[model samples]
Target chain A: MKPRVLAGLLTLALVPAAAGAASLGLGVYGGMSSPILNDTAGNGPQYGVRAPVTLAPMLIVEPFYAQSALGDVDQSFGGSSYTRSGPDVKMFGANAVFSFGEGVKFYPLVGIGSTKITQSGWADITDTSLNFGLGFGFRPMAKLCVDVRGELNAVVTGDTSRKFGNLTAGVSYALFGSE
Target chain B: MKNLRLILPSLLLTGLMASGCWLISGQFTVSQDLPTPLDVDSQIVIVGAHIDLNTQSTYRDHKNDLKDLADCALLGTFTNTGTGTLDILVYMTPAGSPLHSTKVQLDADATKIKVWGPLTLGPGASKKVGWDESAGLFNADGKQALLKEVKGDGDFALYAVGASAPYKLRLTDGVAVVVVDAGK
Candidate 1:
């Protein structure tokens, strides 16, 4: 994971010479995440922060951290009588973005992260997987912005599997004083 | 339209992922409503003892009957109003000891026994927890020892937590006689 983060930073660092421009920005945002579907355990709000470094006008890389509940996997079929708790899971990942200019930006981002879920009466469930984000952001103001993103996370457990997705809108404050 | 295109694929993938996984077993439902106790004039004998499991009956048929003559089974019933889930456990204190102990997940209610032993319930939607119907005795030692002293008109501090109301069965000369004398 450290290697991946270094590679992303290196790409952002060297992009100005090759891609004609560079822009570095830091932002903070909070929003809700819903575990819709067979999501029986957790369906609540999620909050996080992202630091996006732009390389040229079309390219950007963001490293982020979020605290959220990704919902529970039903353990009743495994002969256990207890309900598994969708413990608070922490995620760390980086995304690559492609902006189409104006207030609209469309990007296909990929990252690797892990989520740890604890059960009510048993051991915790730790999952590592790849997560993807494909969506567009709206910069309604130059320094203040509104972004809508769709995320898909595929989590792999020892005995079972689970997935989570969220379509969220956020209000972000740019620390670089530029959008 | 743009948002729809992005979210639709993931939604479809999540459906596939949810369908591929297995859910762990054991369904539990808890109810706070108290079940009415079964009223019987017959002597309700209580007996239980914490005897060594090595001496316990394993034949499936006699597992509920007193083994090594140690425990007592508390017997009573609740009139069925509707069907739901129940949790059951047994409480015991050694002879002349004030501290009481219980087996882990040792409670029984309407459907099943949580004990590591066989899931035993007689022929109906409901089953008796402590008494062995076939052998006419308490299910095991732990139950026998608890009721050994209930052989006469005496009130002993007992503990029982079930889906039914926490109850204390009154012991009469008739009710106490059901418990066989297990000398402490």
Candidate 2:
């Protein structure tokens, strides 16, 4: 993980404040994620934090930082063992979250950003990415909310891409300074 | 000699220039398509006509001189030349060694180092393949056992096994990029 990247993503979250956005929700999410093709890194847990700033009653721009540890890719033939450990991943992005309904909201999200993947003794890879997902948000109190989301994140380079799925649950609290 | 050409320059290659280290690279092409049996298991060997190691002067002269071998890699593509689909299992072996069949559920042979594929190719489709460090595990590359065999012997072969010979398929490719060395 690069400190500069983390700093950059954190900076994007504060952008909504200058616009005097209606509500700002700061939250943490954790869940299971696995790749869909050429699964080099097996399934594992992923966790992240997000700062979602509402621009309108139905729309929010969410900036997030997420990371995941990876499992080794192993194969054996004849007797020699070939082990390719992750290119483990870290991603930072912003999504446009569109909400539907009242207290219990349904949102479908789409976002784009960059990803960094590294493996021991090998070169690290950096690429562009896009994530698409749907989320259900529940509010038990006026300023506190709980949400569950299912997302497909794709890291693309040239004509090739690696895709993974993440399903996560999160809690957020709305701070003061909303319209 | 149909089409195997060593791509490395002979200038830097000597048994003792970097003292016993020869960085060799080459490509072999089979200009025609090979047909595979479709109803039962059948095998094809890429040998003398395609991978002519015998005629290449520098390659022939220095192969036996390599004392310690480095992890090498092969990179290329194979095409499905026929209209029907091709399901192929690829392996590298000491030339003409046979023992795999769609007939057997298991093959206990360790000499056959699988380098590529359960590769299925559609009609007129081409897919690239590569193998280097993982070529022969008979004694592992850096350990020097397989290096002795890879360097000393000629007629090293590439094998392809087809499962279920019901309807055959044709394959063609210029298997490009073979690199072998000593030390790292």
Candidate 3:
């Protein structure tokens, strides 16, 4: 589906949860993303915001949007080499999280998202893919938590597909929860 | 819940394997416009041309010297600045001969010995072409001949005739002599 339509659906899904839910956490995260494909994109910094809403004691749904900074790619044609630099990438997705334990929590996450990569010289590439992640969270206080996660994003564009890995750290604050 | 635990880990493991060191493929297409042609008064010119000599040398301990063998190649670019499509023909003929001095009008059906191209360049577009010496020489009738039997070093001139009416341009820069020695 188109990214804008997916975004609208996500927003609509979040509004009622934010209004009536007993548990909701808002988070901001930053991390390093390494392109794992062979000579496709470069490693760069990514930052994003997420909102997690608890549905059951061990289940949560998180919707997030992340943007990665410019990266470089080298291209060669007919014995000549050219450097294609500064492609900015953006990702939007929703994840289902299954948490275990309290105070210290471990979660396994599965998601689906769309990635848009844009550069100056070449045409824009946009595609959707699946996401997988493993995360750990530490709750020091009733309303504060620290989280670290490693995520893998798989996207395909034009006859080539690549998987990128992101390692991120962040803090979340419970705005409205059963504190 | 126990079954869910087993299923999630299995799915995650599958995702990891799929995203890792494996090759994935897809395809897309992009298009761009052709370059515009130059004015009618402008001509097609030989921007740059060069002959490159690639040599390999090895040390001979018995002879106390190095022996080298070289291969010759011609590389150049031609630009058409005229309003019409440029048709070009390149020739390597003996320098300072009547054939070299002779001016032939650009004709669609003209034939010549050792012709390089009937290359067509759109207006304002530039084309680069290269030829290697080992590729064998050809006569006007496209018969193969040995390079040594043709003409020797510096004995030949490389010239091109570009026709893009109402202009016919003849271009020849001084012959380029470049030697690249790969000696070990």
Q: What tens digits encode model 1's per-residue C-alpha lDDT throughout A34-151?
A: 5432323456567777767664465655666677754543322112222334446566555556566575777676654556544332234565544677767777777666787888
Off by over 4 Å in 1: A1-21, A36-40, A69-86, A158-160, A177-179, B1-184
In Å, residue B131's CA in model 3 sits off its true spot by 26
Off by over 4 Å in 2: A1-18, A79-82, A177-179, B1-184
Per residue, candidate 2 scores C-alpha lDDT tens digits across A95-162 of: 76777997789998876567887755323567666677999998887888899999988665333355
Tens digit of per-residue lDDT, candidate 1, span B1-184? 2453344346545743564432221111111111123221112322232222222122122223321221122333322222233233334333322322332222331222221122232222344322232123334443444334233222233333333433223211111112121111
Error of 2 at B155 (Å): 14
Order the candidates by DockQ, highest first — what do you get?
Answer: 3, 1, 2
Error of 1 at B73 (Å): 26
Q: Which candidate is the best by lDDT?
A: 2
Q: Which 10-residue window of candidate 3 chain B scores lowest in summed lDDT?
A: B26-35
What C-alpha root-mean-square deviation, in Å, does candidate 3 show against the real structure? 15.0
Return the candidate ranking by lDDT, descending: 2, 3, 1
Worst 10 residues of 2 chain A by lDDT: A75-84
Score residue B106 of candidate 1 by CA lDDT. 28
Better of 2 and 3 by TM-score: 3
Say which candidate scores most in TM-score: 3
Number of clashes recorded per candidate: 40, 14, 7
CAPRI verdict on model 3?
Answer: incorrect
What tens-digit string does per-residue lDDT give for candidate 3 at B1-184? Answer: 3454456457656754665522242111111111122112323332212221111121111112111111122234456656678776555443322233233322222333454556677777765443322112223232221132121231233445554345444231122221111111
